[model samples]
Target chain A: DVKVTQSSRYLVKRTGEKVFLECVQDMDHENMFWYRQDPGLGLRLIYFSYDVKMKEKGDIPEGYSVSREKKERFSLILESASTNQTSMYLCASRTGGIVNTEAFFGQGTRLTVV
Target chain B: AQSVTQLDSQVPVFEEAPVELRCNYSSSVSVYLFWYVQYPNQGLQLLLKYLSGSTLVKGINGFEAEFNKSQTSFHLRKPSVHISDTAEYFCAVTPSGNTPLVFGKGTRLSVIA
Candidate 1:
């Protein structure tokens, strides 16, 4: 089965601290995405990468950034963590191109900024 | 750009009863629709997707959804539900060949004994 692995399942960071959440997919998928899931809001995409070294901002990309240095690895970064940034982060990957396909998701990382 | 709207925020029903979760979308172009379920404190799982062809799509765990092009809606349904069916269901859409999928606010299903 295809596997998407997230680096952490739960994390706590102090305000103003830089934080990183990592993800890796073994399916060799070319597209990787980072989304923040909150109660009532569901899942909101923060950023998505169609290829290595290429990224695009999603609707709610205000306080988050992402990096895809390698094909299998995509990383989400919080330059300065804040209380409002506390939420469950999810990583997903899908095949390349615009073909209709469902994304495989990780177990998710729940972050709390204190 | 594409947007999805889940008409109901929460639906409660007794076990063995039929249920339907309504979803609608607005987009200028043709799109792909999907229904995902997220159990408590877990990642989202694909329940079903409607890309093309038949409007009635059957998914895992005895769930199915119908894609109505005229109404621009994809509603998930099940003839009979179980206690294990309790989860948050999200409706998503992306313009055919789009990057990110736009998601709805989600509908929480509560199964009563």
Candidate 2:
């Protein structure tokens, strides 16, 4: 089984604070993703990295950025946390197979910004 | 661009009752379809995926879905549902390559005693 480990399960931050959510995959997958889960809007991708030091913006990447300094680790950075950014964060990774590879997900981190 | 739409926001059914969750997608290129179930506060788990081959795809926990090309729909179904099946179901799609999946709003399944 593949393992995607998240740095924290729950976090509380004040408004205007910078936050970092780290993720690491042991399977050496080539693709890593960060997503935010809200009540009505299932899971929306914030950022994704296909290789080391390579990142792409997803549909909702306005206030978020990502860093992939290594192949096994991807990080999501919230430049300035706000109350609206409080939600569940998920990390997923997939291999670079020719066909579509199923993404394996982390347990998710519930973030609360007050 | 690819997008997925789950028709029902919530579906209520009694134990052992049949249920269906409708999903539709819009994509200009050939895509891959997937059904994922999230239990309570847990993360999403893959229930089934339609890459190609048969139109009817069987998945874990006695769930299955059929792919309709003309309708551009992939609807999940189960003959008899259990209380454990109550969860949030999401439909997602992506192009036929290594890319991120576009997810729908999700349908909440509530099973009564």
Candidate 3:
């Protein structure tokens, strides 16, 4: 089974603090994504990386940045965490072959910005 | 740009009852549709996907979805739902080859006993 692991299952940070959420995939997939899950909004894409050192902004990328220094790891960074940024963050990876490729997700990290 | 719409935000059904979660999409090119389920405090899992061929696609946990190209809809259904089936379901769409997926708001399924 493809495994995508997140650095933390839950995190709490004070306002204006910097926060980082890490994700690693063992399948060697070329595409990685970061998303935030909210009650009514569902899952909104924050950022995505197609290759090492490459990144693309998704629908809602404000206040968030991503890093893809290596193929297997993707990191989501919150420059200044705020209460509005508290959400369940998810990471997913998929192969480069086709767009229909199934993405494997990691157990999300629930971040609480106080 | 591709976009998805999940009409129902919440669906409540009795255990062993049939259920359907409606989803619609707008895309310029041929699209690939997918239904994903996310349990409480967990990640989203692929329930089913409709790439091509047979319009009906069956997935894990006895969940299935039908792809209607003409209607631009891909609705997920289950003959009989269980209590364990309670979760948030999301419908997503993407263009044929190599593109990012556009997800709908999601439908929350609450199975009552």
Candidate 4:
């Protein structure tokens, strides 16, 4: 089965702390995405990487950065954690070079910034 | 740019009853549409997708969606829903490119026993 794995399921961080959320995909997909899901906001894209070392800012990219050093791993970093950043972070991967494809998502990491 | 709008925030239905989740999208060019389901404490799963060809697309768990070009809607429907079908459904759209997907807020389906 295709799989996308997240490093942590739950995390708690103090304010102003640097936070990192790791995601790895076994499907070897070229496109990787990070989204923060809120109660009513659904999933707001934070950042996405279509190729190694290539990234694009999404609608809500402030206060967040992403790294795609390798093909299988993608990371989301919070420069300074804040209470407002407490939300469920989801990582997704999809095949590139085509428009007709669906995304495969990791279980998700619920991050709480205190 | 593409955007999706889910009409209902929540829908309550008795078990074995039909349900429909409305989704509308706006885009200048042709787009790819998808419906995803997210269970409690889980990530989203693709329930169905509409890339092209036939407007009527059938998906897993007896769920189907019809793409209406004139109306700019892709509404999901199930003949009879079970308790297991209770989950949050999301509608997403991406234009004909390698861009990211834009999602709707979501519709939470509550199946009453």
Candidate 5:
């Protein structure tokens, strides 16, 4: 089965603490994305990587950064976790092929900033 | 850039009743549309996708969506819904070429028995 795995399913951090959310995909897809899933905002993209070391900011990139050093791993970093940053984070990877463009998603990481 | 709009934030329906979740998109480039469902506490799953074929596309769990280019809408519908169908539905668009998808705010479908 195709899989996108998030290293942490749940996490808690103190305010102003640095946080790292890891994601890995076995599909070897060219496109990987980081998204924040809020109650009503749905999946808001934070950042996406189209290739190794190549990244682009999405609609909401403030206070968040992403790294794609390898083909299989994409990481999201929060410089200073805040109370409002508490939300479910999702990781997804999609193939570049236009014929088959469905994305595979990870289980998700629920982070709470105290 | 492409953007998606889900008209309803929530839809409450009884079991076995028909349902429709509306979605509209804005984009200048050609686009591929998708419908995804997310159960509580889980990741989103692809229900169906419209790449570039028939306007009416059938998906998993007896759900289907009609793609209307004139209206720029792709609406998901099910003739009869089950309790298991209660979940959050999202509409997404991928503008032609190499680009990530843009998702709507989502529509919550609550099926009451």
Candidate 6:
């Protein structure tokens, strides 16, 4: 079974503070993604990394960035945390298969910005 | 570009009842469709996927979905649902290759005793 683990299951930060969410996958998948889930908004991609040190902006990338220093780890960074940034963040990884690869996700980190 | 639309926001059914969650997508190119379920406080899990070969795909938890290219719809259904099936179901689509999936707003399934 594939395992995707997030660094924190819950986090709290003050406004204007910086925050980091870490994720690691044991499957050594080539593609990793970061997404913020909101009620009625579903899962919107924030950033994704196809290879080490390479990243691409998803639909909503403002105020957020990502790092993929290694194949097994992906990190999401918030430049300046705001109250509106409080939401559940998810990390997922997928292999490089021709067909649609099934993405495995971590439990998710629920960040609260006060 | 691709987008998914889940027409139903919520569906309530009693145990052992049948249910259907509707999903539609808009894409100019051929795409892969998927149904994912998220339990409370948990991450999304793949319930089923429609890539090729068969139009009807069966997944875990006795869930299945039919991909209708003509209708541009991929709807999930279950004949007899259990209370454990209560979760948020999301429909997603991606173009061939390494493109990221576009997800719908999701449909929350609530199964009562």
The candidate maximizing DockQ is 4
The candidates' interface RMSDs, in order, read 1.4, 1.3, 1.7, 1.3, 1.6, 1.4
Summarize candidate 6's per-residue lDDT along B1-113 as a digit string, tens digits.
Answer: 89999999999999999999999999999999999999999999999999899999999999999999999999999999999999999999988547777899999999999
lDDT of 2 at A91: 97
Residue-by-residue lDDT tens digits, candidate 4, A1-114: 999999999999999999999999999899999999999999999999999999999999999999999999999999999999999999999988864698899999999999
* DockQ value of candidate 1: 0.71
Compose the digit string of candidate 3's lDDT tens values, residues A10-67. Answer: 9999999999999999998899999998889978899998899999999899999999
lDDT of 6 at B81: 100
In Å, candidate 3's interface RMSD is: 1.7
Worst 10 residues of 3 chain B by lDDT: B93-102
lDDT of 6: 0.94
Q: Estimate every model's Cα lDDT from 0 to 1.
A: 0.92, 0.93, 0.91, 0.95, 0.94, 0.94
Q: How is the predicted docking of candidate 6 categorized under the CAPRI scheme? A: medium
In terms of lDDT, the poorest run of 10 residues in model 4 chain B is B94-103
DockQ of every candidate: 0.71, 0.71, 0.67, 0.76, 0.65, 0.72
* Candidate 4: clashing residue pairs, number: 0
True contacts kept of 3: 0.60
| CAPRI class assigned to model 5 | medium
Off by over 4 Å in 4: none
- Candidate 3 per-residue C-alpha lDDT over B54-103 given as tens digits, one digit per residue, 9 for 90 to 100: 99999999999889889999999999999999999999987743456778
**After superposition, candidate 6 runs with Cα above 4 Å error:** none
Residue B72 lDDT, candidate 5, scale 0-100: 99
Model 4: C-alpha RMSD to truth? Answer: 0.8
lDDT of 1 at B62: 96
Worst 10 residues of 2 chain B by lDDT: B93-102
Highest-scoring model, TM-score: 4
lDDT of 6 at A7: 96
Candidate 4 lDDT for residue A103: 87
Docking class of 4: medium
What's the lDDT for residue B84 in model 4?
A: 99
TM-score between candidate 1 and the true structure = 0.98
